[model samples]
Target: MVVLNAVIEAAGLEKTYPARDRGGTPFRAVAGIGLRVERGEAFGFLGPNGAGKSSTMRMLGGVSAPTAGTLRILGLDPAAHGRRVRARLGVVPQDDSLDVHLTVRENLLVYGRYFGLSRKAVRERAGELLEFARLTEKADERVEHLSGGMRRRLTIARALINDPEILLLDEPTTGLDPQARHVLWDRLFRLKQDGVTLILTTHYMDEAEQLCDRLVIMDKGLIADEGSPRELIERHITREVLELRFPPGEHEQVAVKLGRDGLPEPERLEVLPDRLLWYAEDGETALARATAAGVQPITALVRRATLEDVFLRLTGRSLTD
Candidate 1:
């Protein structure tokens, strides 16, 4: 069955910023991108810096107008009905924009008031959100006193003041420690369990794999590939990869001899500054053959291919590069 109930829809969506100087061409931040967010699916955009993920998010949030395309949020034209569309969305920006001077509870209450909510209703919701964010004990504390993760959670909580149907989180856990990131991820997981449609943008491979049900890998304002994490890995790369590290200056020499008849014949071979990677169905066999061909490595490891490999294979570059 072809389901058509989408929380956000865009076709040939584009955005261009005005030229920095006169007679210069405008910058195309987004170029003819199309996407659909299902009612309850966690959709994500995975990309490095300058990939236009944030631009697209702003358009969908009803804050930016498309240059030459269509965008509908909650089944309304965002260009014309942006205010109405924004009422149904909760947005967490890349940076935590909490008011440091305001108490945690006060921040939430203030945000709720902007949505035209009654003071009584806002206070009730703020109490619930404080518990949801695990900041009940810090409810009356100044936001400046909170940790990075706590402030992030509070920002997310403030976004939920109107009980939005769709939530947009941009790099939600960028600067947190591992434990704090996990806590935030758990909260997002719970929101997904409650059937809140989530749309997020991130450069972290594991984060995307862990959170997104499906995602698009974007590069230079265009989508390079789209699929679930496992699906992208299975489709774009071998099942396993063998990493071989020889002496620093010897990688080039090894690369010349790799994937030849006398040595390991892998599906693909990549030579980085520090290591040689062999991609194949069986990493052990590839390593064994390479060793037999007079290839001695200082270190060798065989691990299953992941979304990072898929990203590299598709973009001809690492995710961070």
Candidate 2:
């Protein structure tokens, strides 16, 4: 059965921005991107800087119009029904844009009002949201006084003021401590359990793997690949990965030897300044066979393949540069 529960849909969605130079032609930020985010799925955009993630996000949020293509949010055209579509969506931008002058509670109160929420309802929701965000104790405190993580949590609370059906988060945990990041993750997980649709953009592979049910990897305004983390890894890479580090200047010689042996030829091999990675199935078995063949590596570690491995295989480089 082709059950349809998509809340966000895009087809050939494209966006272009004027180049910095006055005489330069416009630049394409998003090119022929097609996506469909289901009602309860946590979808993710995985890419490096300048990968059109933010541009695509803006169009989805109804803040930027596409130069060419179509987008529908909540079954309404984002370009024509922006106000109606925006009312049902929440956005947490990459940069924190909270009103620093207002107290934490006041920030939520004001944002709720923007959605035409009744004052009494806004107040009640503010208290609930503060507890949800774990900022109840800081409700009266100025945003400037809160930690980066606290601010991020508050931003999430503000985004949810209207009980939005879809939430959009752009790098929600950037620059946060481990403890804070986990706290945010826990909150997001709760929302996921409540059946709220989430779309997030992140440079962190672990973040995408942890939270996203499915994701798309974007590179230079194009999608390199799209699938669940496991699907992408299974399709593009092997089950396990082996890392080998050799004292500089010996990798090429070692690589040649390992390639000549009967180990499954790695789907991808990365030569870094300090280490080399071999992507293949059964990393431990591969390592054993390589070692038995006298392919001596300074250090060897076998680990599960990750979304990073899939991305590097598809894009020919690391997501973080």
Candidate 3:
């Protein structure tokens, strides 16, 4: 079993970049963030695009120095002991930067060499990683010949060449199909079971729910909220959600009417292009009340609360937005 000691700690972390124009104005990508990640816990940084998730991950991975504040990874300063800290960390960036000219196994071997591993060790590790990543069958195939999911898995395997104590993944399954995503998730789950500390950034709420033990929601360079998926959902949203679809032009009128007089002014309300979301503590009761109040919807659905509801309630925007 993995120990529960804090492996990563950051206090008042900040990162600001100069503006693109001649004005030299500063753009704060991350601001005053404090976090502690325990060893073997799967922690997630969740936010929409441009919400500083990537920036925070970069700083914690020791690839980018924070503009201010202190960070310690494995009790070592990330800025001062970057090389040493990196040796014990695995990083899988959003973009697959594998060498297309090299075969799958070759890519792993080359990255191992960069870490100063001897040829014999690299070869043995490559074989093991290929099996772990399920790419053993394609070991001799060039990266360019592999599918997107294959390439992504290869990148993940390459990151583990050093047997890192920490694994950092940025959008691990961003563009994969459902089947491919499940395969990746299975691999990640296995790693978690093997006592690997994982830190990831993802826009997919379901992914976070499935993998993270806890997560921070970021917006506009600051953390909006932090908790486990279930905790956040319970705190920020109701137990059930009712979705309704009205006829095309009737949405606005329906929304207005609902806002003016709905079932006890639901916990939260959202009007979408073709539907409306009525969040309430009890879905059946709310639906009954709405129906009794002469509000008729073309279609309706009642579902359990989810992390997406929490994110929307907190940020006032969809995760994709």
TM-score of each candidate? 0.95, 0.96, 0.95
lDDT of 3 by residue, 172-202 (tens): 9999999999999999999999999999999
lDDT for 29 in candidate 3 is 98
Report every candidate's CA lDDT: 0.90, 0.90, 0.91
Worst 10 residues of 3 by lDDT: 259-268
Q: Model 1 over residues 1-321: C-alpha lDDT tens digits? A: 756589888889888999999999999989888888898889999988888999999998999999988888889998788889999999999998889999999999999998999999999999999999999999999999999999999999998889999999999989899999999999999999998999999999999999999999998888888999989988888899999999888888887776433443338888788788888899998888888878999999999998888888878888888
Clashing residue pairs found in predicted model 2: none
The parts of candidate 1 lying over 4 Å away from their true place are 1-4, 260-266
> Residue by residue across 1-321, what tens digits does model 2's lDDT show?
546699988999999988889999899999889999999899999999899999999999999999998899999998889999999999998888999999999999999999999999999999999999999999999999999999999999999999999999999888999999999999999999998899999999999999999999999898998999999988888898889999899887777777734444555566767778887777787788778878888789999999988778888888879
State the lDDT at 2 in candidate 1. Answer: 50
